[model samples]
Target: MALLWWEIFIVVFFVLAVLLPAAVIAFKPQWVFFSRGAKKSNAETINLVRTFMTHYSLPLGMDPLHRQLCLAFMDPFVKTVYSLFAILPDPWMVAICRAVDAFPGNTLRYILHAIIGRTHLIDHVVTEGIKRAGLGRCQWVLLGAGYDNRTYRMAPLRQAYQVATFEVDQEPLQQDKLRRLRKCAAVPPSAYEDVKYVTCNFNTERVQDVLLSANYQPGKRTIFLLEGVSMYLTKEGFAQTLAAIKELCPDDCTLTFDYVDERVINAYNGRTDIVDPPTPPLGSPRSVESTTLDEGMSDCEEGAMVVDKKTAASKKEEVASRASTPLTAEERRYGVQYCSVLERNQTPVTFGLDPSRLETQMAEHGYEIVQHWSPDELAQQFLKWPGGKESKHGGEIVSRACTYFYYCTVRPVRGSAV
Candidate 1:
């Protein structure tokens, strides 16, 4: 007997809901890193694909860059997943992302878009650092660079500055990346002239020694890209890694990274005031775009304040009466939901900074904050562009989640080069 249309639909949904995820997990075990690992570097591949989807679905998607960087690295199974997401309609695809979450706002689409825009921001920051490194003739080092294809994607970088290095902890993922690079004919051997890959556990190994053994030049300045990596580390691990960078590199070196704010790190309830997600300059197409919540405001206490949307709405009058400085109706509902989603994740933020003392704190560590961009700042910048199609999509995501993260570029203080 033939089944009815609704029955068939139910059957297909059941298969996809149960069998598909199980198949993905079994065949692509690395995908688990996207959801529940302490060391989630394994999920970098999954993250890369999500970023690819962000570019794939949007008008501003830099098809060329993502295609060159990500598409070539995906295995057959991953390729199938990518194709499915890419082929589906935008709203339907976005719903697929959102459906993963029980709640509406904290959807997979939001997270994917966040990854895409932020990755673009990182790309721009690293590109600038690369230019500086080229001028200084320093080596480019990507610490904890997981599934990062920047070395392979930017032909100009390859042609101009040849020295590059990618350091990762996991051997399997590193091996897989290497294999994929070899498979993808887009980047030939001549393209990656002086590249090196170092495999060492940052927690236990001396990162300095690992690089030194890899023929990394100690006297030369270096461009360090430490993206999406610090928070997972223990306090001791974080300090040790920073110490290694200080001890090994010269003062002329440039370091670009993003971090969680102390407020978010130690938020007791889901009520931390919004801090802008980290962001970069607006010079390049890939650079982060944003506006200031208030002029010269460095922290939440200043003019830009964030409050829990649900709580603030109920206590608007009471809150306004209690505090001389109260968040506007908009500011409380404003900002990215990224942190709220992160709070729900199994992996918790272990370290963060106090924005008020950022400059001083960095100074104490022999580093100076060259630039800092909050999420609000980034979104404002994005909205300023004339025909920023991608920027609009990315700007919205960041604007919503900006309070959850912070971005900055830091350089070693003179006479304190590590």
Candidate 2:
């Protein structure tokens, strides 16, 4: 049987496209991308990239899907090829990639941290907070957990087998992730015996019901970790969610989460590669739901919105009134929602309040803020980078930017006098 010219060309292309890359990965692996030190010190880097790409793609935002697809395709290839050199064991490499495929947005965030050598900073801070809350032996809840491996990786938690961990998120999303994880990194169920998966939509799930179902007790010292999620929620939605936490947790419970400031959100508005709501109407008050730090004000009292209403209004008016707009294809596709994208295409909406305000709100609701880490302090801690400083992004490094606020709180024991 003689092959036609087109058939011959197709065969050649297929061989080069698929088989060649595989062969290179299996054989001459050292030629693969990434340094040996990087693979060892930051295995989660690739996973972060995968997570970021997944979030960017799954919601069908303004960014070209093709760009995300290309990164997804390239990521596994890099990991596979790199692992053949034994810098990173095959199992670990596969596990990282699988986790990335499981939660792309989070994976990408981790990858960025890895690149910047700041993953340890986050891990350290959270670990300290958890320990300080006296949750070393208590149950831990990871909200929107999304393939986080901390339950297994954090040394203290691993040593305390009495500690039960529950990972909560949407069921379908987790199931799909589990399938991919099984295909790539097939760890035995025994590895996760202390961890349980609770599938629930954050928007609809009854918090009390879910916690009870997960064997959570109200009087126990519990820690809730909410990272990179606040911006996606509406003001009411975010506040109601926190109120539920306060209601369910005992007096010793601690909650830690991050949120962007209004200024950062405004700066990021209309940028491609993000998911945000339409630019809010001019002079619109920042949501009262957020927490801010005001030196002269009592906790919970409203402070100035991080972004001045006049300023935001003027920018919106300018964008709206433009005769020849230069919005990107993604901005056009996603419309106003694209404004939500923050640094590197992640969501950047701030709920409009600061840490002090949140502390005040929590106090009223029976929770008291114990510690607050401002962006300046975090920047000083993380950005020192051994001997010297690195270039700044928009003169607002992650450590110094007013983009996020993190706090720890403990609920008062019932019947205790204020």
Candidate 3:
């Protein structure tokens, strides 16, 4: 009995030895801070994976090159985990992908591609936009580029059309990704040599000036992809970037980006998820409800009653607004988890735009909307097996995530636009 007990104890110890750290990584990310401090890299933790859709979407016949790029950029120690997993049958990868898809991100979209094939749908949109921009006549710029391999991945289109490709990002991160690409891919130098890398710190630098300094031709029609970037920037920063793009590109140039709804911004700030309704200007007639309340009150009571009625109507409006928008720290309980790891790392999500006002907002920057894709629409179009069968659990996942974000394209216009 003693010998049997010892064997069981040893088995349990080994199991925990293997699983405890993994659990810490997945659940207790604060451990990263206590142990070694936040990772010093400016690159977003989700950057590689955001573009690495191909890795998990392998079963769906997605491009495999981005997956290779992701594996290359991973830490050697982390890469070993994937290397070991590679020993399993391919189904394991598909299962992992599905797990990520099913794990709801709520409003913290900085983590997973919760809707599935989101990046790919953006890729498809950009590609189509480039076609419309006219082959060899337009320039393609990727803003806030993070290990983005679109320039290399779209090699055939680039080479055939003589597409002028530029990837703009912070200097250090741009260097890091290039170095990783060199080490990871065994392909010829031509694979990545042609693309220009323009670097800037969005807070302090002008993107338009840098692009021009880097020989970016403003006269050419430009298709700019600013993926996973806006939410990290302040509203002023994003607006300046937009203004710069408008300044740098001529009319009909394209800009593609995704932004979460305002509630996502509130989620990060721990603010009430309720966005106050568009109130009529102060002293605007509070007519119907106020008149109805006055009819029931005596002159002595009328004054106090009117005050109460106004307060009640205000409360009513607030409640009505909050009906669709959930409290951040409460709702799905994601508020507590709202990318807390990213918050500690100093890269917390900070910005979001109201979708209803998006086109009107872009119009302020001399751009007009060309197209938009909600998360559900993207899933409907791309979340299918190559054999044309819709994947399981796609609908519920995407519909819920829909309230979180949108993929939109806007093009520069000559004068005012709406």
TM-score-better candidate, 1 vs 2: 1
Estimate, for each residue in 169-213, the C-alpha lDDT of model 2 and write its tens digit: 767645644554444332434445557788766666666578778
Residue 318, model 1: Cα distance from true site in angstroms: 27
Error of 3 at 365 (Å): 2.3
lDDT of 1 by residue, 57-83 (tens): 434345465576576655555566556
Can you rank all candidates by lDDT, best first? 3, 1, 2
Worst 10-residue lDDT window for candidate 3 reads 286-295
Please tell me which predicted candidate would have the highest lDDT against the true structure.
3
lDDT comparing candidate 2 with the true structure: 0.44
- The models' CA-based lDDT, in order, is 0.54, 0.44, 0.59
Using all chains and alpha carbons, the TM-scores for the candidates as numbered come to 0.66, 0.51, 0.74
**Least well predicted 10-residue stretch by lDDT in candidate 2:** 296-305
Once model 1 is optimally superposed onto the true structure by TM-score, how far is the C-alpha of residue 306 displaced, in angstroms? Answer: 30
Quality of model 3 by C-alpha lDDT: 0.59
Deviating ranges (above 4 Å) for candidate 1: 1-42, 53-60, 72-80, 89-110, 132-136, 268-348, 382-399
